[model samples]
Target chain A: MSASLPYAVHETAGHDNASMTTVGFWIYLMSDCLIFAVLFATFGVLVHSTAGGPDGKGLFELPFVLGETMLLLVSSFTFGAGMLSAQAGRKKQLLAWLAVTFVLGLAFIAMELHEFSTLIHEGAGPSKSAFLSSFFTLVGTHGLHVTCGLAWLIVMAHQVVRFGLDGIALRRLACLSLFWHFLDLIWICVFTFVYLREFL
Target chain B: MKAPLPHSGMEHAESHAHGNLKSYVVGFVLSLVLTIASFGTVMTDLVPHASRLATIVILCVVQLFVQLVYFLHMGTAKSQRQNTAIFACTSLLIVIVVAGSLWVMHNANVNMMPMSMSIQSALKHP
Candidate 1:
């Protein structure tokens, strides 16, 4: 059965190539998801093991986190707009939307860094307790992914400017859109499991 | 200066793009509503404490599917079935690992030796 196959299917090759890239990116996302799952499990296990330190109830600032969430969420939406622009072959619109998304992404990271610094200054540093340690690792990993994503966005924006809406640029933008949306998905889980669950 | 993308090849892509943009808009609005709902449920004292956890859990799951279908285009005919299959398998593995760890660790904490008991015995022996 394996030997009888023909491999000369160039008619559908473009679609196949696009789907192949998407599938590969999906696998990457799944692996990233498992890493987060491990981190979340660690947080669940140690959330109560505060080691005589402050817990989530004492440390989390809901309003600040809500602001951060809004920023990231809007950025995801903007990135989707950019993808739509790319598909429609609107180069200028694509660049404009991408620039907006990048700004929102930067703002989100700035807020996150400010929050982290405040927590550390207030003696709730990761090393101070098991709860904080798991908290930092899980949230920090997500922050790192966002940082990388910001960099990717800049590179892709540059490519779109140089290449217009070529096949390669469209494919790359689609993959990045998936990555950006995946980050939003992960953040939803983080806020639900890590932040909101604290109040519960 | 450069010629526009081929009309024939992109006809399908163009139509799909318009439909996809609508989904993105719908997804964005739905996600915002869901976020507000979760936040309101958690912050307000509307629901009893006992059921609050379950409420948020259900909300999270619902929001997850919303984003998956609308934003990620997970179930659309345009998306590849193989991608969906891989995602389903990945989700199963994640559930097993996360739930398994929490279950085992929770049981361990319940059955473990008391820190006070361990400390006192160590001091006495020394």
Candidate 2:
């Protein structure tokens, strides 16, 4: 019966390939990290150059930002659940968790978009000041990455359904999980250095 | 159903590949706590000014590692060793580049004597 376990052979056989894929994806994520690092450095340098425009204290709303943080963090947790389901070869659970992750991700993006629109409407658009420029660039880049991740989640969910947690699909799902969690990691930095620090 | 051999290296190894639900929950809880701590430190005037920044930074760093270890399942296992090295090197480079550039730019600002006002004066005088 152990020999006949459906996922056992595939799990063993896919180990090497999965390892390679995981490593490769990690390298990609590291490069992405560098991109964020540059944005962060730029933001740091320009944070004080408000050019008579509103500063973080006036621009950032803690409660709204906190809501966004909660959504992303919970989505990361849901993505983890999906990955666990994938590992267990429970396709329905995987799909359910992924669906939840996707919805939470969408909510995050919606909140971000709303914030951006509010800022722009308040005459704090990126071009209005150097501080705003860096702010938008740093945070907008993150929002863009989240958008892309959502798209990838959709593709991966579709693949899981089509492939039924085959070795390849499962490996791809693992990569996506890493990506999702990594975004959450970056968001922690953003929340601390950008939003919360404003109050300090 | 035959019991899996206890000494089967592959089975033992694969067990560590995909993390279980417990570890995921652990990571989630840790991160949530750290996040709340960060928010509390900033939202309230509880922490002293000098140490508040430090506290927030420490919280962020700890939460980052929690996500990495629990959610991402990153570790020093043999299979993950290479990826870890790659990440460590990339992180070092990021620190150098970001920190170095910011230091240089800040130092330049310190040396410069209010150039924007001077620029206005120059246009007026010329």
Candidate 3:
């Protein structure tokens, strides 16, 4: 059976270039999910302990968090559209969608950082309370990821412009797609268990 | 090596993408509205105090599933089976670690305070 194989099979056997980048990025996302899982676990364990300090009910602002959630959700959709545009080989549309995603992500981070600063200024710093510490750590870690994602988006935008729809650019875009979607996944958990859990 | 020809179903996939975008926008809007409604429930104290927390938690969980399915497309693709499995396992582990630890530690806190208070009194009078 091995001896009777077609030559075309042999020729193309070693050239399976089906984008490995997507697979690699998926693996990265799994690992990142694990990281978020660990943080979520930590927050869950400590959220109610509060060490005689203020609790989630006293500190959370549902309206502001709703705005932040909306911003990130919109950004994730725009990023998805950007990926679709790239797959359709529409470079200009892809760039425009990416720019929208980048701006929205930046806005999210800005609002988050402002919230953190205002909380600290009002004597709700992490050091003052266990609840505040876990709250900030969980939310701050996400904000940091968004900041990094925005930076990555800027770099990828330049690459897309400089190299149009080349394979490398496509790979980068695929990786960004995974990262952006992964962030959205984690935020859903955060919003549900951490922020909304307060109202419960 | 030459690039492979564009798949024969490229146009179909493009149309599918457009449809997916429309669905995603609709989902986003619904989630936003649900989130706002949940906040309103909390702010207005519409529900009885005892059940208010449970109601908000249930709403949040429902909204979370909505976002995951409509926005993230979790478990939607054959190729993503492994990814879905990993996520499910990690989530289970998280639940165990977090909820388990909270229960244990809270019980410990309740049980140990009396012992500590007795010891403090003994020491003070001695």
Candidate 4:
């Protein structure tokens, strides 16, 4: 009975190019948010359950963490700037900004891994206590996302080079944009509740 | 009525693409300053524990919001409604799980009496 729908209607209502990407990216963000939410909950429950070991007060180094946070936040901004350049079809500018974003994100992950190594060296390994375990899980999850994002950025760069401003390419860029920004959002909560709350 | 797929191509073309890179820089510097301030609070013990904690939390929250609005363009017209809804739901779920678990665990510890206490002592001693 419904075989003869208008082409425009079919294009709009069914799987149009733009909405498909937008909706898919939104769904991805939602799923990613759920994962982070789980991590946040894990951290929250165990924040005080130190299991007779050092707690946030004793373990958290705010200066180092602050530096890491800055790195991530700035990188998020740079990524947005890169997206802006992409939208404008400014290939050189986009590439430059994307490179900056990638470097900053890498730096952030390096600092975090270094901090973890130092903590483990200082006898504050995740096995030391539940608090540390949760801390590692939450922060490590974020680092992992950044690593994936860096990989995705590389792939997207290759696509941009090969395809220029094509529909599928733009959609992928949009998805990456959402993913990067969502990571920033998650970090904000981690910084406030996990690191900053020690002082509170 | 079938809605036409909102062609991102047209939107992409129409949208003014020059980013507020200057604002991003400003936000970045501000975030750095806030981070430093929080660190200072942690290291120096200059403020009372409660006050310092509150200050740091507030600063972090504010800084995060700054990052979202300035850097991420979250809550912008493009995906604001959907993004906000997702965030709100996730946040609510987080609260329920975290708070519920903490409460349940605390109560269980209290009810179980010497079990957790003994465990705590045993770990402390061993």
Highest-lDDT candidate: 2
Better by DockQ, candidate 3 or 1: 1
**Candidate of highest TM-score:** 2
lDDT of 2 at A165: 77
Candidate 2 per-residue C-alpha lDDT over A1-200 given as tens digits, one digit per residue, 9 for 90 to 100: 13124346544433566677877898899999999999999888888888777999999999898899999999999988888777777889999999999999999999999999999999999998888999999999999999999999999989878767777787788788888888998999899989988888
TM-score of 4: 0.79
Give the CA lDDT, 0 to 100, for residue A29 in model 2. Answer: 96
Tens-digit lDDT string for candidate 4 (A51-110): 677888777777777788778877877887887677666877888888898999889989
The per-model lDDT (C-alpha) reads 0.81, 0.84, 0.71, 0.71
Candidate 2 segments whose C-alpha is farther than 4 A from its true place: A1-7, A10-15, B1-11, B115-126
Among all windows of ten consecutive residues in candidate 3 chain A, which has the lowest summed lDDT?
A1-10
Question: Which structure is stronger by TM-score: 1 or 4?
Answer: 1
Of 2 and 4, the candidate ahead on lDDT is 2
lDDT string for model 3 (A6-103, tens) is 11122222222322445556667767777777787778767865655677777778888888888887888888788778866788999999999999
Superposed model 3: Cα runs more than 4 Å off? A1-20, B1-19, B114-126
CAPRI grade, predicted model 1: acceptable
Worst 10 residues of 1 chain B by lDDT: B1-10
Q: Work out the iRMS of candidate 2.
A: 2.3
Model 1: CA > 4 A from native = A1-15, B1-19, B76-78, B115-126
For model 1 the local lDDT of residue A176 reads 89
- Residue-level lDDT of model 2, residues B35-59, one tens digit each, is 8899999888889988998999999
Q: Flag clash pairs in model 2.
A: none
